[model samples]
Target chain A: MNNPADLRYATSHEWVRLEGEIATVGISDHAQEELTDVVFVELPAVGRAVDAGDPTAVVESVKAASDIYAPISGEVVEVNPEVEADPSLVNTDPYGKGWIFKLKVKDAAHVSKLMDAAAYAAQIS
Target chain B: MISEIKSSPLEAAHVVLGAKLVPFAGWNMPVQYTSIIDEHTAVRTACGIFDISHMGQFIASGPTAAAWLNGLLTNDIAKLGIGEGQYTLMLNEAGGVIDDLIAYRTGETEFFLVVNASMIDEDFAWMDARKNANVTLRNESAQWAGMAIQGPTAVEVFAKVFPDETLPPRNGIMTTAAGAVVCRTGYTGEDGFEFFSPAAEGIAWWDKFLAAGAKPCGLGARDSLRLEMGYPLNGNDLSPERTPVEAGLGFFCALEKGDFIGRETLARQKTDGPAVKLTALRYLDKGPPPRAHYPVVSADGTVLGELASGVLSPSLMTGIGMAYLPAEFSKIGTPLQIEVRGRLFSAEVVKKPFYKPAPSA
Candidate 1:
């Protein structure tokens, strides 16, 4: 699976898409593939404060548990309940409907420091 | 991941089917193909096959084989007739389980023993140190590859694979013309057969079984299937710190058969009862699934013990797990709590086997 060209990625495998002040976050396709058969997801609550690289959420597969990290500093404005109810979406459509949470950027310029799609693709490979 | 993890003969086939391979018990084995729940449900409903080549297999033959085994194992080996098998356990002097295994009486003086993969070296060394001059012990694990074909439709698939052969009945083992040992047994609660063949032949059979409509399942589904049946995993539920008395596997341990390795300790535990008892539990509140090593506590906030095995039971669609709790707190319907990631959730001690086999029509 290829990382979406429009999104920025973190070293921890979370992808971020910035729309004005709101930054949407989800795990990379490679991340979901590694953690196969995701049975449950615990999304961080809306209004929670998170800094870049913070362990913000959790994804659990049948075999193990992994922490989802924050790519940039922000306050969580909304969390995707759909992904929480059906965690497999993170595998099927990781970048779109499977977006985990949306954060109101505390520092919009920090997103520029995140890795590009090509860089993430190289890092994972 | 261990750098020296061994790969099974079916490794190529597993990769071709897009299985997620992981290191388990020093073997690089497939953990899942699609989703664990999907593969688990397939076995419970239709059919599924697993590559269980990592487990250890041993052959003991000679005039003294039966008597030596009787001295080593907790089960009544004398009662197992030719072509029959019995579940048994090897215990430490203190009555702690070394490993749980199945011993098959193939001939008048020959027996086959199958033990857990991780405990192969330990089990062998322990037995080898006490080796009798009359018994011959051979480790056949590296020479053979094993497969478990399971479910209600397993017989049909087996028939398709061996069109001219007769399958063994439950608890029976037969050596095939192609040098494969077919045992009418499985870990999944469903009716199935476990086949062990030469490494090369085993890979071919795995492919043929898939072509014949048997789903290629992995260790993930195997764990859930066995857990649903309340089967105790060797390293997890059965450990050096636990005995058959606490595991609720006393039926397999026959004290009346005479003195075995841990006979005295086991007899004392049987009469006096054990301090810890294994119990089945299901989550009352929906949240993240319980996992091994998670703390299991009493209603009054007393820590009982840690969960031994846990999973989001695919068949029951609920969180199910097994834990060794204090005997007083192990009663059915007793309220308990599980602490996962510092959050407590409601749970209860329930009956054995969270999943039951459907009644035959």
Candidate 2:
């Protein structure tokens, strides 16, 4: 429920934090807690182009696997290799170390379209 | 949307203890409280209780209850003694399993049976259609809720609450302090008690169990426990399309009995040897947990079978699973490959109860 000031959220639970043209993406703490003991994380490869709302990643919990959709259309510039090596990172710190990928946002202004910290907190709480 | 699912009587209590709910048998059943591994380990090493009220129960009684039930189930009722709970399966006339259940004779003409919640409707219809003139079958599921408290220390937890030997000693049944139909039984590989009570009162019973120092566990831990013991759960491991014999559940099939709905069919299949036999597979290393329906293939890439149930065994601390493989490849030491996430992982067929049951179970 920590509404990190730098991040925006999607209704589907993905978080996006814009830094100039790049938007780092990951899931929220509320999400990891619901998923429980993440065992596997499938991250989108760097340089891959994704459209908004597309399935770009997957996080597998002990019981089930869920899709992590792309929050906004962008090109993947980098992915969190740490999560691939250790999916439990999502459980430990989904917002920081567990951030899935760095996106080269198609439009930096698109960040405005997503849920702000207060709105995302309202959505989750 | 775990919260979107309906809550059980114990939902609030479960959330208060930090349970993770998942859709199970049409209800939002808690899959775990702390972690499946931690909870699983606790039940195996100490004591744990589960809110299993979502499981369906029914009462069958009349002048000819035994005969009527014998005609419909796969087990030999003649082998049962009053107050003793027996694990058995209900099979269709085609020899396929309807559900794996427990039958307990509460009286000379009365009996209590538990069935899977998902199969309640169909099970009721099937039992009703097969009812005889001297017997009556009633679906008592909606009125009841159940709890399964299992582990080496399980008896101690219950003893504190329902003392004076209110529990059925070592797998026996007795009325308890909570007015529960306390059955000494369980699916976990441990000594345990399963309490059946009014649905409205289940949450209170759950709270008492927790207060008694029993860890609150859920369906995820339950699944791991049963799998570690190689117990076949209905619908997943055993289904209407697969006979108990093929499912490696022949132990529960009473071939000595006669005239049950699937008696002749099951008897023949038993002699013929089930075409596909259930086998336990242990991943060679600490690999990803196998999943249901993952293809099991021969070394030459021939499709041998498919995984019926699988998970990272918190008990074994390694990936474990069950599959229906050809009888020829069912040897305990056979090496196998299970395709997971579009890739193959090496595994081995091992003599199971993949986990060793504590001496108490």
Candidate 3:
């Protein structure tokens, strides 16, 4: 599942890499693998405020659509245009170029409360 | 309330291939083996095999079988010669579809029927209660296992599996040297044959087909392949309250033949014109894949109806779907909107089939 140790994960399969006040969010590799072929990605609009567990984006495979939830409360600062143009990036490079959005964290402490990489791995396993 | 889900005879094989199993119509069936797009492409370009054991099969025989069946089903059964098959529908007294199935004339007095899985019991009960004294109906679903090998290379794969046997002509049925029944027909608009064998020998035959080069496909690919051709899924596209006339399936209803259970209503709708028609729609631009139950709207913001079946076509790389819309909006090139999660995507009513396969070499 290649879940990096530095990133924190939510039970819903999202991962966050906190860089100071701004956090980059994307689905975990394990999540992408489970989704198989990613055909379309609906990114959250920039400047939209979302609470933890709110559905902020959508990822669609051939069979069905899944909502990507906001791991923690934040205001969307940016969304990945690359993923919108080529959704397969989410399946091929979920941690890198496929990152869905950048959020200005409302509470840095809430990010710590989420599962660390080891705990996320254990939870998925 | 918990109910038992039936398992396919090839369940173990699917598990070994790491298939994603999901509950479909009261059966635990494989929805995908690899990815839906990958499997769908394989069937379109080469050969792909699908487990159809969960579907229901029946055998009708007797001196009066053909006559009896014609009175119940919409198609004229007497028109089919021995070894020939025809796609037909069984409807209720009000002309509403009960089930859509393929009827094959296996012998002078015998016919084989392949019906939808969910309607097995209801279909049987309906026919049984009205069966003539000279007709005998038998539900042989549990005794047989079925597989459909479809694609441009399907015939070649069939030859490799049964070297000595020849497949029947299109929509024809013939028995093999090993007592298996092979029907030359498929839902995917491709050259293919459906094979039915004794239940216990299912795994062996599946392996033989795979060894002969048919890629394993599941229900997910099956849905997309059929929808590409604009074929209706019984539960999704055809239903008890909708008649064949409204569904654009009047061609299969043989209204000129004689009186059938649903003939009167169909005849009336055929002459007066159905109020609503099952229409096909395609996306004008890139958007999320359309799905069933998504609301379909008009350019003027009128809520026409919801999609009966929808999918993102792998061949066309666009969203395509079907919905029952008012007659005024069912014409080809009519602009429409598909609402998904409060967002509307631009689309238009296209022709029946969203895709057409190229001529076979």
Candidate 4:
């Protein structure tokens, strides 16, 4: 249930860490915990353009599939192949190695509007 | 803003163990305790205990119970000796499956039926509509709590729990001294037994099994285990629109035995062949797991059918599912494509079971 204070999150449970013009995106720990076992992840291809609120990826558990929505509109700069190979990384370290994709921020200022760790924590609780 | 959902007798135990509860068929049931793969693996390698109390239970016993059941069910009830259980189907007049259940002959003229939770009300009404004076039908779901202890090590765990008792053979029910009926049956393709006891003692049994090393499994692991075995789930794999023949469960439908509710249509389908038969699909290439309602299509991309149930098999370490496919493309090794989130993944029609138990050393 750790929500790093530095990270910003979405109402849909995605978390983003922005540095300069790049934003690293993954689901929150609460999201991974709710999903239970992570068996497969379908990440957006690198360089794909995505809008905020758009489904950018899919995380599948043994029971069902869930869409991972983009927190901020941007072009995908890179994808995390590690979580793709072993989906449990998302469950084990959702805020770290489980980072799904990096977005080249189209509007870096828009990231500020998302909820902070405390706000996101309150939203889930 | 919300109405109440029924909880199992072991709901408190699930909460103590930190289970994730979800609404399933009008019941607040646990979907998982830990991860699904972890629980699923435990059932395959060791033993896992599941609270199946949401399923419905009914007692039908009287002067003409056996005869009435034979007409109401697809299986030949006359053949089932006392203590023996057989998987059977209740069907609509058109041969569509109402629900799949297991009927256990408990005495010379007494029977017990276990049916899907979602269909309990409808199933009861259907049976009652055909009821006559000679039989008594009672809905006993509230009085019992059911638990499935399943896996390779299930026998050992049962022995540890009931040290002095001998479990019934497969498909047999042994009434325990404590009034619990232990049935040598399970949904997972492994050796195990399902225990039905008075509702009040369910939590105690759940805790005792957990203390004895049985993993607390939820519906998530249950889905994956049964999917790997190609077992037809009531709502997902079998439905009022699907017949037993189309579900690849013709063996359970005793057509020649006598006329049942849906025998005419089933017999015709058996002779004419089902247009679309339930078949198993295994991923030929690794990708996102196929899920329910994902379209199954041909190489040319024409939609043939949709996946009835699909999951990433914890045992096979690959995606597996059951779907209705045209009889022409239902053979083993037939190449097929499953459309998952707008992408077609390579898959093939495989044998029913995507996993098999390891041979004993």
Top candidate on DockQ is 3
Error of 4 at B229 (Å): 0.5
DockQ each candidate and list the results.
0.71, 0.37, 0.89, 0.83
B108: Cα error in model 1, Å: 0.6
Badly placed stretches (over 4 Å) of model 4 are: B1-4, B359-361
| Cα error, candidate 4, residue A96 (Å) | 2.6
Residue A15, candidate 3: Cα error in Å is 0.6
- For model 2, the superposed segments whose C-alpha errors exceed 4 Å read A17-23, A44-52, A72-81, A103-114, B1-7, B15-23
Which residue pairs clash within candidate 2?
none
Output the number of the TM-score-best candidate. Answer: 3
Tell me which of candidates 1 and 3 scores higher on lDDT.
3
Which stretches of model 1 miss by more than 4 angstroms?
B1-3
Pick by lDDT: which candidate is best? 3
By summed lDDT, the worst window of 10 consecutive residues in model 4 chain B runs over B352-361
Please list the C-alpha lDDT of all candidates, in the order they appear. Answer: 0.90, 0.84, 0.94, 0.91
lDDT of 2 by residue, B296-333 (tens): 98767788989999988876667889999998889888
CAPRI class of candidate 3: high
The positional error of residue B341 in candidate 1, measured at the CA in angstroms, is 0.8
lDDT of 4: 0.91
- Please give the range of 10 consecutive residues that has the lowest summed lDDT in model 1 chain A: A36-45
Candidate 1 lDDT over A51-123, as tens digits, reads 9989999999877889999899999999999988888899889999889999999988999899999998889
- For model 3, how does the per-residue alpha-carbon lDDT over B12-61 read when each residue is reduced to its tens digit? 99999999999998999999998999999999999999999999999999
